[model samples]
Target chain A: MIKPELLVTPTSVENVEEVIDAGADAVMIGEERYGLRLAGEFDRTAVHEAVKLAHERGVKVYVAMNALFHNDTLPELPDYLAFLDKIGADAVVFGDPAVLMNAKQYAPKVELHWNTETTATNWYTANYWGRKGSARAVLARELNMDSVIEIKENAEVAIEVQVHGMTCMFQSKRTLVGNYMEFQGKDLGVEGRSKDRTLVLHDPERDVKYPIWEDWNGTHIMSPKDMCIIDELDELIDAEIDSFKIDGVLKDGAYIRDMTGLYRQAIDQYAAKPEEYIEEKEAWRDRALALQPDNRELDTGFFFKETVY
Target chain B: MRTEVKETAAADKRVITKKPELLAPAGNLEKLKIAVHYGADAVFIGGRDFGLRSNADNFSIQEMEEAVEFADRYGAEIYVTTNIFAHNENMEGLDVYLREIEAAGVRGIIVADPMIIETCKRVAPTLEVHLSTQQSLSNWQAVQFWKDEGLDRVVLAREVGMNEMLEMKRNVDIEIETFIHGAMCISYSGRCTLSNHMTARDSNRGGCCQSCRWDYFLYEDREDANAESGNALFAEEDAPFAMSPKDLNLVQSIPKLVDAGIDSLKVEGRMKSIHYVATVVSVYRKVIDAYCADPDNFTIDPEWLKELEKCANRPTAPAFFENTPGYEEQMFRNHKQKTPFDFSGLVLDYDADTGMVTLQQRNHFRPGDTVEFFGPEIERFSMTVGTIWDDEGNEIDAARHPLQVVTFKTDQPVYVHNMMRKEL
Candidate 1:
């Protein structure tokens, strides 16, 4: 049998059960106001239910409290963390250090998964976080496979790598798209921003076209092409990466099932016939490619190339 | 919903007595000394290795020691920036480098990476650690996180607005610094990879060609078609400064910043000329000192504004401190942002014998043209150029050649790197 190891952000209650059903070893949940995913809809009841469902199925549930907290919100986090701990979350994934600092003080039970929002690129950072009570490190999306292997070799903290989905090219706290819309006199909630009217920009010098949008969190200028590395699951497993992450909290259940199922199948097949992985790699790539949304372009980003200055 | 941050209780009563530090950027040793003379309380600079701003004439061990000595005379501090996110390979020589910086008497090390922060704590525990804005700590909770991590100071992110800053001061028990002036990053604090994807240069590591400021065209590649080709149908299109934020100018926001109890107000131009450093620092220095002297009477001055306007080359906006800037704040994309004055020359040496100044031409200047000469401590002073001549005493109508040292007749004598500019 294939060694089971796949993690996905279940986004909502609508997909939480389905995500677990589709062979995910773990599922991440987030509240709209708390995590980096501003479009998230989970509240206290929803989050409690998600953790219960995942735990019942013998699946680990990690709740994301990954958004950077301002002074005002920092005070509110302790109660939320206590709630997560009360609901029995297996891990709490967060990017901000303040959450960890406060969690250590007020709500100490929730296992902290430090996600530095692409800042933890090296082995030393992994080792550093491991020392600081981080149960896992969701490595930055920018790192190549070589770096990931190096991190795994050096770090005692378990590593989680995003194996599939949309990667942010530019993330800014200033609401660029929101400000631009307000300038046009459109009230955000009243106007109901759609993908049809999404602002598409291309830096002619770089010739890179990207989609820019805003939520409560701020503007996210995303790469035009989404990333999919399910075809390379064997490589991650060989490198001893603990978790293969699917980055789709913003996507729907159909997306959730399709993406999660593809990675599950890929991992299973690769494990069943370790020597046959190379021979069957093309078929795996073809199957994974078919599962992707036809409208969106796809690429194997930053995986093949090292980020050298 | 991310609601607008509310103004907190006025912290004026608690903050007005003790003066906040006026921090300036020193790209070179000369600029470091000039900045302190013009009233910079501290200077942040790059080292020969590991520091960001690879293009700057970063300090060697000797220059850093000399710089520390110079700043000590004025009771100013020197901070070395090793803000680059280090990889495993990059960790070599890091311990040696930290020890070297500490031995050179650097007051602090501004860092973003936890590994580097750990290294600093391990090797140079004596040196203070200031979190670089590159880490993008917009929230006070994040500031507290750095504090717990043993960092002494936290540089607030540019995305942090005025109200948020006040709240940070009220809540976080750490020295808070904010960038008051200079180029704002299009990306969050400094996390970007546009340069990396476009060119081979990784922005996080330092070789930022400022790909955001490149001439661009607004091309709309609609989703309905062009799936394969990625061709765009045109609108009224032009792309210039598409990603360039108008340079931040908070000179007028001195009172609010003072009230917020911000520990330091940083000026952000490391690759700028000594004249730019002198002009910008002195103006901020005057503004900060005026506020400290008479808190209630401190009003934004038109003269100070005029002096600042002549130095900066880009269009200025009160960036995120007030609110998010609109479309008008963006400089033109097809060309560079227009300035009222161009950098005309640099004052080299003054000759009492000839009553003339030897100047190096940066742009171009002619005889009989009025030019403004300003230094670190001095305000704008205009002098009419009588005659211009090259090295061999041959009089030339115009000093056109770049980096050509020429003698020009002047009534007022000036020091080295004192900028002279002609009004356009």
Candidate 2:
């Protein structure tokens, strides 16, 4: 089985070295203006420093600029793309074509990764954008294992899959939290918009609480369970996926480091000796579960589901 | 009212190169015919497979052929939806499905999946590829990306505002379609998975449970030290949270839309009733024609809005058109939509000599109830029901049975497919 690159999202430029030491082959960082629900915002100076530090350690830096850009935001992409290019970022993760257009003109050297959140389900679309210039496609988390393997085999571009962390269940451009407060005739202002407020939505019919928050972009509701695929690493690596992404958005530095270290051990052990790793798979799963937040459950997301719709 | 609109429009004599195409939804073969009869320039329908509206009474290949033929006679085009975000499993028989719809004489296909788009382009070369709004095309460069790839048209995302659309038009030469009226998804189309996560229904694959409209109790994280110590702070009684957006209504913006050279104006609802399809399509049709006839002197008829209210389930607003919507655009307290009228019946036939109008009953309507009769060709007029005869010619006081064939006397003539509705 080929070893897949373990991609971990870092909380800051200062956190880059820590995650790399924890065994990250690549680090993804972005500014809040362009990225949606990023772990932390890195300014232009920080981006340059992060790239230099990651490259020195034989690691790659992927910049996140994947917001659905409106007319007001599209014009700012050119300069940002140029800066990423100047700093030699490995790729610019994007969902909007405006980013692709601006990158082509301003930073032709930077690689493009098609990550349209939910639309990149099959290989043909991946290849479609691959033909246009995307170097990789992030498969939608809604896909099952069979679909992922099929896409990995057929797509001309590299395939990246999210193997850990909270999954966004819904994102709306409307400031739902702020609107609720206003509708209530209460002005919580900063408290209402702050992501640190730890807001959640509880459906009365179900005994689950979905984490909800508001940021500069809009409202985001997260799933009740964090996707922990420690045991499934062997399957993805055996399938020869290009990259294994561990999203650290809304997570603490300790969580990112622990997850990166565990996934790294699993991926390495599996590659080194598949039989030995198989024997110890349950132990690895337990260790990962022990690290998970008490409030959040852990599941394989849609990977093991027999059916989705 | 028609004469009055023309009189107001006569003052402005500017000519547009083309009047925008009026697109409507067709949940079934009947809705297809009704939309065309009511003046839809194009009608989008979902075939039995690979569309996002699985619950709709979608068309089969045979029915699609019939719909295409009927629409052709009226010079209206038919576009079938193969717009599901397809998985590898959904890819089976898709090439054959594309060819089948093409052979059925579908003018185009609405698709979001790249495989479907590429397959349609390869196997069904004759069918135009209209990118579904599920892609959330908010900028011109994205439109240009598809245009460069050889797709024919792009349906602007509901979140794309008017200024953004105009910018896109200035930048791209491809056909542009905008949703003039419909229910708005609070999240960007195809970006939401609340339904998939909440109810095991893949909204991208068309089994949407609409979990965003579900009532929920809001609370701060209980694990936080500052979290309210008791249920008093985050109880369901503190007003349940809902993110359901009001429906989009752009009737008043018809002149601007026409003047902007938008290629098509679409109404969104495949699962809507026949009455809804007719009323919405006809109102847009009337407003578009009036504005295009005289751009400068055009004014929206208040009656058109009133007619829309009869079928409106949710309150309507011009969402994301003029500006980013605010608190007013969402319904947080309650999600259920209410309409002021009930669709009473559909006209089956009219005997002019005997002054008899036969109706197919939909909802309960009794004798002495005043109902309005409106058709594609006739002016709307109210008639007081006097005496009714059942299919057997027995006089009945009320037409309570669904789809019951009943007859009434009216001096005015009516045609088949004409609708009757009563105030609720």
Candidate 3:
């Protein structure tokens, strides 16, 4: 009886067959990484193609337009919003208030999700976004388990959290890497020698180097660690969260198959024999951790207590 | 050549002069010395109170005095940060802190609040005020607004790119200082509430708990929901900490920065270690000096780059120098690998004639482990430990005691000023 949602990266899509084979309830498709540089024109044809493919198999497709848009770029919103509506995108992820306001007028039928970049730290912001128009609010990456619980308890809208993929090292949307890039006369979106731009922080005590690369858009660096929450299924479910979102734009089909397969098994096993599910949970945790990047440290985050600065 | 590319290749290249000042961070007096020694034209520091980093071993009055003297000796400027967002209670010690800073002969005070700026103007007029990035100066309007308020300098918001910077530079007359390197805030400028909302600690006021770095899960269904619908689900994913990219490094881009006519290149990490100050300042100094000496011949030394790599870092990217990409572009897929080396020991004394280097064993080191000697202006040597003598001069296979003075012979002469460390 447990409802499960998978936030599939459109980039994770191999074809309509792969999505149908995975049997996911819904799919979130947009740019691999969301931002002004990468959030180019929302591919209407792709959206139409995805929606047609997903609908043919009874799966819903959500379009991601989740990047902070400046006031200067406000005039271009209506067209993008209308495009989503015309294409019949199941939903659209948005971070900017202006975009939301415009989306309300232009594409009222589409479900709206508050992107994580809005940095909705508390229930007030979450509730506010929900009230304003967002059907679901993507919680900030900084939220601990307790805070997430508090948000779920307090939020009026559905709460979606990033379940997997590379976590961001900076705040969503607002970053200086793009500003730095614009200064250097290089377009971040284009793939070229622009990849060589490197940000390094010196850790003198450890005597080691930390390097942060600019994304294709040049706004912010991608996080080194991927979020894997397969282990704490019981704890998360107990918190009454609404949806589980996975972030894998560049991942292969096996990733989706393996991850979805494991989660499906865990949810089923947990429901079948609650006590016996502990072993299944451990096995799933091992699998999830094995899929993560090498030598990466993992933490329970804010779920236990507030992390140190 | 491509058809479109060949046509516009003859665009005019404008020449620029008036190089920006180099502003460095000093965590303490030792770091201050290293920064100045390594070629920081101006250095910024925080005091124990009224500064953002409460955890930093900030400057005491005596240390401040020494720092001022050191800057004066090196013909450099020292700017003290009084930039913390002031609450009602924080205001009680403000007058005293300001008076003490003025007495310390600081060149300027970096502040964010308008009330503090006004107060500084009234009380400590001699101390120039540089607006902190917390004020969020992104446009000519904001720059003009701050300049109208009598500010001498403004630290532009980190969200601004170089194109906007150049545009603002063209419009605003006030001195512009931007963060060239170090830890970046995930939030805009410094206006983050993730810490305050998640915990009681306020990030805007600078007491951040850094709740962003924790792992997260994407749940599909409500935990208490009925299983029949197949719509509700719980999925878990581990999220990274702080949502902030690693600090900025523009060492290789010094020439471009100089050409931009920026007023200052600011290095972040006021809470960093002395070694960080030395390593960063030394490398930057070499790069800047090389460029100043001959712009065309300027080349980043391979050794300096290696030394920088020796410090903890993920993959490096030029932050917002060219364009603004999103989180995916900025995210590092790999965490910095902890060096296999441990700072096992330091040389306490050296007898040049005897060819013996006396050292205190800080950590356990095997005889086979490779050791690196860190010395000023010298290439770091990779040497293997050959023979070891314990503190009592007894022949020993290894030294493992804390503060255990050990001696070993080197192929070449080593100095007491240099420290020896080995990789595990």
lDDT of each: 0.77, 0.86, 0.63
Per-residue lDDT of candidate 1, residues B1-424 (tens digit)? 1212223236553224566899999999988988998889999999877767888889998999999999999999999999988767789999999999999999999998888999999999999999999888878777766788889999988888999887777766788899999987866755566665667566777777686666444333454533235443232432222556778999999878876778889999999877688779989998988877667666888989988887777878887887766655655543244567778887778877777888888888897788888876345688888878898889898998988889977767677667788888
> Each candidate's chain A: what TM-score?
0.91, 0.97, 0.79
User: Over the true interface residues, superposed, what is the Cα RMSD of model 1?
Assistant: 3.4
For residues B167-232, could you state the per-residue lDDT of candidate 2 as single tens digits? 887878888899999887899889899888777888999988888988776777755422244432
Candidate 2 chain A minimal-lDDT segment of 10 residues: A186-195
Q: Looking at model 2 chain B, which ten-residue stretch has the lowest summed lDDT? A: B1-10
Tens digits of lDDT, candidate 3, B140-211: 555765786689999987777777777667766878898877777655555455454345465645577664
RMSD for all candidates, in order, please: 4.5, 3.1, 14.7
Q: What fraction of the true interface does each of the listed models get right, in terms of native contacts kept? A: 0.50, 0.71, 0.05
In candidate 1, position A85 carries an lDDT of 78
What TM-score, computed on C-alpha atoms, does each candidate reach?
Answer: 0.90, 0.96, 0.55
Measured against the true two-chain complex, the DockQ scores of the candidates, in the order shown, are: 0.45, 0.65, 0.04
- Sort all candidates by DockQ, best to worst: 2, 1, 3
